[model samples]
Target: MSRPGSPVCTPDWLALREPADHTARACDLADRLADRLGAWPGARDVVVRDLGCGTGSMGRWLAPRLARPQRWVLQDRDADLARRAAAATPVPATAVVGDLADLDTLAGTDVLVCSALLDLLTAPDVERLARLCADAGCAALLTLSVTGAVALDPVDPLDDDVTAAFDAHQRRDGLLGPDAPDVAAAAFARHGYAVHRGPSPWRLGPADAALAEEWLRGRVDAACAQEPALVGSAERFLARRLDALGAGGLHAEVGHADLLALPGTVR
Candidate 1:
């Protein structure tokens, strides 16, 4: 999924949104994942490989919650981010700079985890991942996949048009975009894995002014990229939304979902 010109995630952007991402994750899925893994108190053999582990936020949030001694294998295309994640993690950790397949990293992996990643993959890419995990006999916890739903408070007439454009942009070049989670579920099921899905929408308000501002800016930009004709209205819309956000009168509910696919039949 590494495209030559794909937007690389910036550290500042990742840090700014970490809290919201943490709060928005599906706790029930993690709890259920824990139950499936069972209580392995003091067991240090549990291995969690975090693909696209941006600054190790997933590990920091989920490791302690698992309540088990485990090792973390953080992978990222960015060398710096991978190194930072390995260093910051509070457990025995290692960073893989290149592709996991290059290192054969998944051979003994117990769980595969990804966040905000599926939306960037194609349907065939997800199928390949599911097939790989099934072949490797490991579980997967994929989260924060957009479902093409966005609700902005104090609705504006231009909202729907811009949203439609952005959704189209996300799916351009054959990426799954909002449909990734569902596509992933069906793929895993075909491989005999028990699948679970849950909501992980980001509910932003004044408290999230900074993140909301950045997100709105990027969204409008993407929408404009998808449809050049939307330039004028998108500009006006972004300005109005920024004003509302600054005035503390705006709230946005961005739709996202989490999926847990475990090997074997439904429990």
Candidate 2:
């Protein structure tokens, strides 16, 4: 089940990063997931249920890559996003308006997928997700979980400070934050899935200034929000950042991780 987050997702923002997201994702993991699903005894007809299908980005990225006839089920907490995602997805899609909870009803999906979603859940929530997937004997391809590492070219004096604060903000509400990928892998492994992980970092360069600037603003804003004391220098740091970005001299490598889990091991 995909849960909503504070400010991690929005249609416009999701659309803006789609290209980078696809590029940053580890293609090997997707290919591996496709192979596992291909051999799945239950996949006479493949069903990919994207939990929290915001902007439908996950489906658009994954469906064609799979070598099986599939039906996309895009579920979202926002009804409009659900319907819009269903309509815009390249493949035929069905939209369901809701979150995936109530484990009793988690069956019927051949494969589970979600992008940038695991971090929004708690450890118990993640364990439950793994358990549910294992019980249903479904494979999962969970992608783009933040890894709490941001490297910026021409680093600033306060870059580490801002990143630390931003990460703290991510963990403020007991959320997994950058710890999601590891936690998810362990959870899946504990529940009898053979889990695989690979780095999916966004390597942004001069051409990605727009996205980089937007990412910088959000990262700084979240940092300042978590620790208001960073404001004075943060404002100054932000200015220099914008100036560098405007001059096309800025680059950043934002960290993320992707996970692929195929059932059947220690159950």
Candidate 3:
């Protein structure tokens, strides 16, 4: 999947949406993870490796809830983003700048985590990640993978059309996109992980006008790109949506899923 908070990813976009992301994430999954780890008979300093960690938002949200003495490895392909992520991390962290294709190098890690990343990966890419995590016997907390379900208040006739086009665009070039969550869950299950899933939908309203506006624009643009014939209707639809947003009559629910996968007891 694509990296949202990494160097190739715009920091401003990530920063602008960070609060909403924090607000929308499945906190219960984190609690469930904490409880699972707590029940481990040999609890010790936990090691967490965040893949594609953009500005350390994952760490910021997960660290406090996890037990103390946690060491984080904030990994990204972008050095600048990695450095920034390290600087903002609340726990001790080592920032690694390298290819995400090399994730298998993180063998023996306790937990593997990522946010807004799985949707960019192809099925095989996710399979490889699952195999690596399974080999390491690590728990995984993967969050914010879009599920292709979005609701817009004051819905327009073209809303479903644009959304469908956008979902198709996301799956372009064989990327799993919104299908990643299900595919990854199955992959983890096949590898002997007990998987749990939770919904983490973004509820955007008038208070989030700026983010909502930008998000709407991107959605419309992607739809247009996916189906060039939709350009005319897309423009009209975007205008209506923006107008409703400005008038405080717009609300949106963007669907995302959080997954927790814990390796089963070793024989």
Q: What tens-digit string does per-residue lDDT give for candidate 1 at 50-111? A: 98887999989888877666899998878888889999888899988654334343678888
Estimate, for each residue in 1-267, the C-alpha lDDT of model 2 and write its tens digit: 234532237778888899999998989999997877676564366888888888898888888899888888888878788888899888889988777563355578778999999988889889989988887888899999999988988988998899899999888778899999999999999987888899999999888887888888888898999999999999999999999989988888999999999887421
Best by TM-score: 3
Give all candidates' CA lDDT scores. 0.88, 0.85, 0.89
RMSD of 2: 2.7
In candidate 3, which residue ranges exceed 4 Å CA deviation? 1-6, 41-43
The regions of model 2 sitting more than 4 angstroms off are 1-8, 40-43, 102-104, 265-267
TM-score-based ranking, best first?
Answer: 3, 1, 2
Q: For model 1, which pairs clash?
A: none
Provide the TM-score for each candidate, comma-separated. Answer: 0.94, 0.93, 0.95
Q: After superposition, how far is residue 174 of candidate 3 from its true place, in Å?
A: 0.4
The CA-based lDDT of model 3 is what?
Answer: 0.89
Ranking of predictions according to lDDT: 3, 1, 2
Error of 2 at 209 (Å): 1.6
lDDT, candidate 1, at 3: 59
